[model samples]
Target: MKHLSYLNKYFLKYKWRILPGVLFVIISNIFGVVPAQVIRNAYDLIVENAAIYRLYEGFDRQAIVYDIFSYSLFFFGALILFLYLLRGLFLFFMRQTIILMSRHIEYDMKNEIYAHYQKLSLGFYRRNNTGDLMNRATEDVNRVRMYVGPAIMYAFNTTVLFLLVIYFMFSVNATLAIYALLPLPVLVLAIYYVNTIINQKSEKIQEQLSRLSSFVQERFSGIRVMKSYVREAHAQTIFAEESNAYKTNSMGLVKVQAFFYPTMLLLVGISTILTIYIGGEQVIDGAITPGNIAEFIVYVNQLTFPVTMLGWVTTLIQRAAASQKRINEFLQLQPDINSGSQEIDLNGNISFKNVSFTYADTGIEAIKEVSFEIKQGQFVAIIGKTGSGKSTLANLLMRMYDPSSGDILIEGQALDKIDLHSYRSQIGFVPQEVFLFSDSIKNNIAFGLDAVTDEQVNQAAKDAAVYQNIIGFEQQFETMLGERGITLSGGQKQRVSIARALIKSPQMLIFDDCLSAVDTKTEEEILSNLGKLMKGRTSVLIAHRISTIKNADKILVLDNGRIIEEGTHEELLNSGKAYAEMYQNQLLEEENV
Candidate 1:
């Protein structure tokens, strides 16, 4: 019922088209009823009255033959033409209405799912597979459209057509009609039971299918790494296992479908046999005319068709129900990060007050009771070893995840109180792993900005030290980057991402080990450019190398999810603590080299 309610809006939108289509269906069915009546009348004329020729005896024999031929041809021809025209027109409108409704419903579902995804905390994505989300957006939405479009219409038509045929049958011979319909209730119940089983199996099959898609997507994305390690055979074996699982589930569904169709056919056949035996007995006993018996048989066959379609409609509904459940689940998910109702200008003054965070799945604190403040336009550096929570801190600042305890503030207002779009628009993030869409280099660099000019894109690329690289490509800025910038080298991809962030001219900038792929010389040059760019921006640099943070106004060294040391470069070196030890080790390694 809830799923049916979901389709009300779509139905209302197409009611005009649907109304005419349905009226045409009724007219077509009326024409269909005419054939049964014609058969009845033909049987009466031929068998019941041998004196049928007496009426034409007074006319010339040739004239009678011609008149009968002309009348029969014109009457049957017109009836057939009317039926065909009504059926064609109804089908035309029905198809157009269903297609339009399908497209609109699919569009709405995709947009809603995407918008909900945007509102969800990063932790949700971290725990979910990319392929699974893609499947929900595409496959699940398509299933919903199928239900709202064809399934609903077919179900309604089948029900209505079946009831109308049953009413006519009963009107002709009440006892025979009741006997023929006795199996209908049992058949319907059987279909419902079969549908329930199919729905359960289909849900499992869809889950397995999603897993298969995820496995394929992951393996393909990591194909280069697998080939580099000579693990092609191993990857293939894993993929085969997932594919086989999908096949196994699909075959299970097929088995159920196979049994269901045969069972429905048997039920319809039995009902037809029963109707014939009983109606034929009545005709021989003079309880009904031969024409009436003929009409009953025709109506019986018509009833069987709708019954047969009942099985298919049930199957479609079950499949759609499974899909709807998955879509509803996604829509119902609530983001952990609350965007509270308050507005404030983001001036880049950030403060962390006793903040702590844990990954949702593991519940292991990644950052513990960390507190810090960066004044507006300050250049702050966070130095940490692998898994020391530096990236997690940056994530908190971006509102990707909220702290498990305590609070973070931007410009003297709670982070939660700020509008997410406004706050995020004011900040730029360059992640350790650069991501580029399959688009022209110029477009990639100017991704989030509105209608940027080529000159502005080139200047931003130059600032990020990537303009030379772009110009060397065959198409320069017009060159399309392959998926995830696969056609570009690691350093070039990183620089392009940097240019994308820089083009935004953000008030706050976060570079999370974004320079790791670039060579030392290029890294130094880009860093020099960044120094100038950071003059009036609050910038946070997460780095492993001491050189990257030496010029920072303040440096915080993190160890094991806690800040172990904090001070200026000279102050940290003079303290002879963790920061000094790290700096001294790097210096000794350089001297040895």
Candidate 2:
């Protein structure tokens, strides 16, 4: 219930609608309860008039008395029908106001969660899986909507109807009202006991559903790997086990609900029986009339639905409370990184002052007190072996993370001081792991820009050396790719990713081992094209091959997260150090190939 307090702001936002909805509930119940009294009065009219007609059976005016009796009963019946139609109309208005408000709130809640998710740091994604995040925004929000819409509506309707019905019954005769309501206290206790169990079960079910969703999402995304490894049967077995567990949990909830509803109906049934028996005895004792007995019966039947809904509304609220708690867990988390207010052109000399970074999750130092400088228009190359922190440098430059110690500066301004969006907007980064969306090839190339001409996409593809491959397709640039660009070869995917970065026409370019999937000939051609385009723009190249970066103005050779050698290609080759050894080995490998 406390967790559900988060929705108070939304309630306040829609207060005007809610207030009208409450008014409709009250009006509708007033009409609803009055029908029972109308029917009671109509019955008493028939009973009283029939006795008069019997007394006049032998008189000459008996025919006139019968006609009058028939017309009065008809009027009362018509009034009851009219009252019920009015109740139905107000019920419709109630749904329109309150239920629609719930829907609007659900829409707002999902958008807010999605926007917050985008603001969170990469570390947040690493900690929470995608399925759990989706469940909170979608399924959990839906459960809360049940509380917002149906539960709130029925709770109000029930309370109003009960109060009105009880007032009428007690006004007629307190003995019958007392007897009819005696079973309700036990109903309240039953709901209180069942609500706690439902809350616990609902939370467990949501957690298990999230796990199942994650399993399915991962398996679908990696279906190729599973097939290549011939593990389809094994995957199926595991899926079956997970499905069975979900079923088992669902059945546990169903069992409690099974016990809940019948208990409610039994108490309602007891109330009805007591009403009939007690009202009959009072009629015989002359404390009340036969019409009074009929009225009590109508009241009991009128109260039947609202009493049953008490159990259902309790279930909905308990489940909603559990779901809101899960949603609050993420909504309450503040993002680890906060953006700065500074906005400026980011084209300048870049410097890292003794920068060091450690991955918080693995506790492994990826960058250790490394320092470097890149002038405004210099082409700088960083060559390293596997696990030497090449990609980490690219991530840091893109501001995906902040260094654990030291500082990064662009021109004279601190990197963190610059507005994050403004800084990243000027840089084109092609990651080591190429990922393209499931869209047309042209669209993937033009993805970073808000708008682009087809000619620009074509030119960028040519510059990345993927133009020939793309044109060979029947649809050319319009060819649609599968997930992660699976329709293309590994080399083509990397080339398309490079084209996407190039299409941005940014002030700085960072390519982190983007040419690994392509052959040496394609790599040389792409580098030649890049050289022409990178003129007067700061560029950082991280590579495993020496040939790709031999023409750069400055080359850095890293080993074990440290810059062991720094010089131009010629200087490093002559130094006979790690860079020289790497170059010699690559040359021999090329000759053998």
* Leading candidate by lDDT: 2
lDDT of 1 by residue, 141-232 (tens): 88778777777667756766777777777787888888788787888788878887888887887798789888888878887999999998
lDDT of 1 at 376: 84
Put down candidate 2 lDDT per residue, 519-589, tens digits, no spaces. Answer: 98999998888888888888999999888899999998877887888989999988998898998899899
- Write down the lDDT of every candidate, Cα atoms only: 0.82, 0.90
Off by over 4 Å in 2: none
lDDT of 1: 0.82
Task: Give model 2's clash tally.
Answer: 0
**Residue 208 C-alpha lDDT in model 1:** 82
